[model samples]
Target: MNTYSDLRLNLFCQSLLQSVGMNKENSLVVADSLIKANLEGVDSHGISRLPIYAKRFGDNRINIKPNIQMTKKSSSVLMVDGDNGLGHVVSYQAILNGIEMAKQNGVTAIAVKNSNHFGTASYFCQLACEQNLACIVLTNSPPGIAPWGGKDAFFGTNPIAFGFPTGNDQPVIIDLSTSVVARGKIILAAKQGNHIPDGWALDRDGHPTNDAEEALKGSLLPLGGAKGSALALAVEILTGLLTGAAFGPNVKNIYDNEESGKANVGHFFILMDIEKFMNLNTFFESIINLLNEMKEVPKIPGIDEIRYPGERRKRDKERRLQEGIQLPPSVEEELIKLAGQYNVEFPIPIPPLKANSIVSN
Candidate 1:
């Protein structure tokens, strides 16, 4: 394992992306999104993804220079065509547009099509929250989970996220995948030759498996069995079918090298300007009061504290900023290889600290 400061990782990622023909601005946007995930302790969606993304860029699967187009459909609705661009670039532009539209109107709904896999959904939600806008984000990926009572994979993990601004406090952000676990975590496990816990997925033969590789070749279980499947179906409809992007098994797998086509992933965002509905201060007070009351409720034995959704993530980011992000050895090796291939310099690993260095101090 190796640790690296966020700044070094950011520079390394930006250089690699630029080598693959991405613009400087777009590279920074993508790198920032990935690093933010790491800072928030979501390592599965962090720079571990860059190697695959760079491979896709080299294969011409992702468009580095995309002709993104936005169409205003109604007073509070819009559509975006990503032109097969990187998902981070596409979604960043979409959220910015949505935030502006929500400011003008009370709310805005933006649907994006022809984008590749975006990193974490929370990244975009944070962007909206920074602008003092509440937002709901949804995106569909290649098939990973099966429909209820089905053996074949038919739905993506299909994450959904919501963010609410709290004036002086950190915005309340909630993000979750419909699957029992994010497919990326399984992929990371496979890469590191680790076993997953049971009940997370089934083998290709429809039997439960702890092997990450088998799980990848099979189907992921839904978050809450049938109910999670139903929610995933709804996300597929909004992000895939409604957006005119590929859906179900038709969405191409990001890791499949044999199938050479764009991913055509879709994302949907709803942003609301807090002031439009109620006084911002009043809304903040109400939300804080509700959170405080919830926290004051009785707790089970051995429980320390009850925290709101985004509180832990905020703390994780602060800690990681001081300690640096750690990368698994396998992921580090792959990143080093990518750096060599791209003719860019990989960031030096942070030196490990020596114990008892302050003896007799």
Candidate 2:
């Protein structure tokens, strides 16, 4: 395991990305998104993905310099073409436009196409939250989950996220995948030579398996059986069909070297200005009252406290910032190789603490 401060890690990532033909501004945005995911304990979407991204860039699967364009469909609707750019760069630009339109027209809907994988959806939501706006984010990915009662993979492990500003500095953010677990978790396990728990996925022959590699060749189970499959369908339509991007199994998988083409991932974002409906303070007070009531009523055995959505993430970010972000040996080794390949300086790891040095006084 290796630990690193966020600033040093960000610089290392930026250097590596720039070496791969990405511009400085876009590299900074991508690195910030990856590091923030690690800080919030979502390691699946963190810097562990750098190797795959670099490979795609080298293969010409993702454009190094994309021409992102936006069109105004109406007073509250906008369309974006990423021109095969990184999802982080495309989505960040789209959300900024959406927020501005919402401030003028109460709400805005933005559809993005021809993009690659974006990090966690909550990151974009946090941007809207900073402006006291409510937002819903949806995105389609490469196929990983299967439809209800099906043996083959069909729908992507599409995710949906919602964000709302509150009286406190922390906003209410809910982000989740329609699958029983995120497919990235299985990919990370496979990379680390670890076994996954049962019920997360099935083998290629439709049998349950704990092996991460086999699970990758198979289909992931839905979050709640048929219900989750249904939600995934809705996201597929909104992000893929409605946005004119690839749908269902047609979305190209980023990890498959044999699949030669763009990912064509799609995203949908809706931003709503709170002041349009009512006073922002009144809405904050109502949300606070509701949260307090819920906390006052919750206590099960072995439970310490009741935390609202995004609260634990906020706490994790705080602790990680104070200490440091730890990376697994597998991820660190891959990063080191990339550093050498790109002729970039790698960040020095924080030394592990010695047990004998601890003195309890």
Candidate 3:
């Protein structure tokens, strides 16, 4: 296993992005987002996705110097054109605009189009939580899941995320994909030559399979059968259809090397100023009380603690900050190869592995 401090990882990622012609500011934002995902223990959205991003940038599928623009449709409604930029850069700009608009108008809705894979929705939602605001974020991805009872793929994993100020430093965050699991997890499993759990995905013929590689060649199962499909449909409507971006089968998978044209991904965000609804201090105090009450509830059998959504993530982040982020050897090797190809120096020092932990390719 390879371990890295957050600062070194961020700098390495930024250097790679810069070497590929991304502006300093955009590179910094994207790198920070990726590192944050790693810190939070969301490996699927972390540095594992870096090689694909680099390939896209080299292939001209993602624009390095994008002219991202915002259009104000109303006092509280806005639209952003990403100009084929990396989704991290584009979505970050949109969220910033949404936060400002919400502060001025008490609420705001911002939609983005022509983007390419943003790391994760929770990253932006947490940004709003930091400002003492409530946020909901939805994004449409490449079609990788089928609708209810359908064999062929027609919907993206389509994640939804929400964040609320918890009256404390750590906000309540809920982030989930409508699919049974995030597609990136399957991608990681494939990279590691591991098998997925049963019922997570289907083979190309629509039969469930535990093989990650087969799942990749097929479609992912929805979270709750028909219900998850419905939620994914709603996200598609808001993110892709409403935003005039590609939806359903029209969206291009990020890993498709032979696919031509831009990704044209879409994202939708809703932000609310908590202070506008009631006194901020009072609201926070009430939340804290409710959280305490929930904690007092009896635990189920064999359960040690009742954690709220995002608690585990917060804990993981704290531990990783004090310790270091761990990377699979394959991921580290890919990063090293990417650095060499781009003429960027690998910033993190790799430690010699002990016996029995070496991963075979």
Candidate 4:
């Protein structure tokens, strides 16, 4: 394992994306999103996924130069065609369009089609929240979870994220996948040659399995069985069906190079100006008071604390910003491989570990 300051990791990600022919602005968006995931302790959506991204880029599955175009469907609705571009670039642009539209129209709904796998859904929602808006973000990916009472994979770990301001620089964020866990965690476990805990997924034969590789070949378990499946279906409908992108089994697997053209993933974003309902200050103050009330609640014995959805993430971000990110040995090796493949130097040089070092692994 190795450690790197956020700045160094950000630079490495940016340079790697640029090497794959992404424009500077697009690369920065991707880099920041990935690093933000790492900083917020969502390693499943962080730089660990970059190796696969590089592979897709090398295979020419991702458009080197995307011309993202948006069409207005109504006063408050927009549709974006990603042109097979990186999902981060496409989604960022779509959110930017939504934010601007929301500023004028109180609320905006943006649907994106023909995109690749974007990093974290919260990253986009949080972006809207940072602009003093309330946001809901949804995305669909390659099929990973099976339908209820079925063995075939049909739904991606379709995630939904919600974010809103709380009178602070950091907004309260809630992000969850319909699946028990994001598929990326399974992929990461497989890359590290580790087995997952039981009940997380079923094997190719539909039997419960702890092997990450088998889980990848099989299907992930839904978060709450049938109920989770239903939520996943809702996300699939909004992000894929409604957006006119490939849904269910029609979406190509990101790891399967033989599947054909682009991944054709889809994302849906809803941004609303906070001032639409009430004054921003009043809304934020209400949120803060509620949070405080929750924190002051009586606790069950043996529990240290009860934190909000975004509290831990905010703490993680601050600590990581000061202490840097730690990458597992397997992930570091993958990064090295990508650096060699792209003929780009790894941005951060590892330093000898010290007791008082800011970054170490």
Q: What is the lDDT of candidate 1?
A: 0.91
Instruction: Name the lDDT value of residue 302 in candidate 4.
Output: 98
Per-candidate TM equals 0.97, 0.97, 0.96, 0.96
Across residues 88-107, which tens digit of lDDT does each residue of candidate 3 receive? 99999998988999999999
- Per-residue alpha-carbon lDDT of candidate 2 for residues 284-345, written as tens digits (9 for 90 to 100): 99999988898888699999888899999999887777667889999999999989988999
Looking at candidate 2, the ten consecutive residues that score lowest on lDDT are 352-361
Q: Number of clashes in every candidate structure? A: 0, 0, 0, 0
CA shift at 106, candidate 2, in angstroms? 0.8
Tens digits of per-residue lDDT for model 1, 243-346? 88988888888799887788999999999999999998899999999999999999999988999999999998877787788899999999999999989999
For candidate 2, what is the lDDT? 0.92
Residue 164 Cα positional deviation in candidate 4, in Å, after optimal superposition: 0.9
Which pairs of residues collide in model 4? none
Alpha carbon deviation, residue 236, candidate 2 (Å)? 0.3
Comparison by lDDT, 1 against 2, better one = 2
Candidate 3: stretches off by over 4 Å: 350-361
